[model samples]
Target: MTLQKVNLQEKFNLFQEQWRPKIVGELNGQHVKLAKLQGPFVWHHHENEDELFLVVKGRLCMELQGQEPIWLEPGEFLVVPRGVEHRPVADEEVHLLLFEPAGTLNTGNVQGERTVENLERI
Candidate 1:
């Protein structure tokens, strides 16, 4: 198969819905994705892996239980420790680079509106 060079815009274009992640690439044993998020999400955590979120545009906030929420701006990134419960709240539409395993659900253990069982590609 011929190799394809997909850019950020191409990946961004693939995102058509909110809180859904589209896999873009893979590094080592992890999958790299682009997700568009807005509004508040349920508190959850990855039981077996650390998840990293890097804001590509707009503000993204991570609220930890009983702790100050962490705000990520464009060019900023945060790695939430594995098994640490956290909720994500976005004031406006935000684009992000999500690094996690291939089967990782964006909302983790929460089975709600935001969970995409079959993660799409953007």
Candidate 2:
């Protein structure tokens, strides 16, 4: 078993593909995913689960249904409540860590661009 505290940053570097998330670790039923994002992602939402996003390196813009949206940096995080439509945009290459369920789709509610079907790590 793994006994050391996992460094999310190192795990994120294992994958060089954008939007493709790697299952790094798990905590409290939440699957920790490390992904590098660029460009804009499809607009979607999770109908039954809240998604947590933490920027590990760059900046990200997350637009929610009825809110002003949030811009997160390295130490910033945003918990997108369940059932809310949101879109993520990255002006530059960004490294991020996500907290959601194991089966939760990266695209969430609707499937289109940026949807990763099968995820495998390096």
Highest-scoring model, TM-score: 1
Model 2 clash pairs are: none
Candidate 1, residue 71: lDDT: 93
Give each model a TM-score: 0.91, 0.90
**Which lDDT tens digits does candidate 2 get at residues 44-109?**
988898999999999999987788978999989999889889999999999988889878899887
Across 1-122, the per-residue lDDT of candidate 1 in tens digits comes to 67888688777975568887888988688999888889998899888889999999899999998899899999999999889999989999999898987788777778887778987665
Model 2, 114: alpha-carbon shift in Å?
A: 2.1
TM-score of predicted structure 1: 0.91
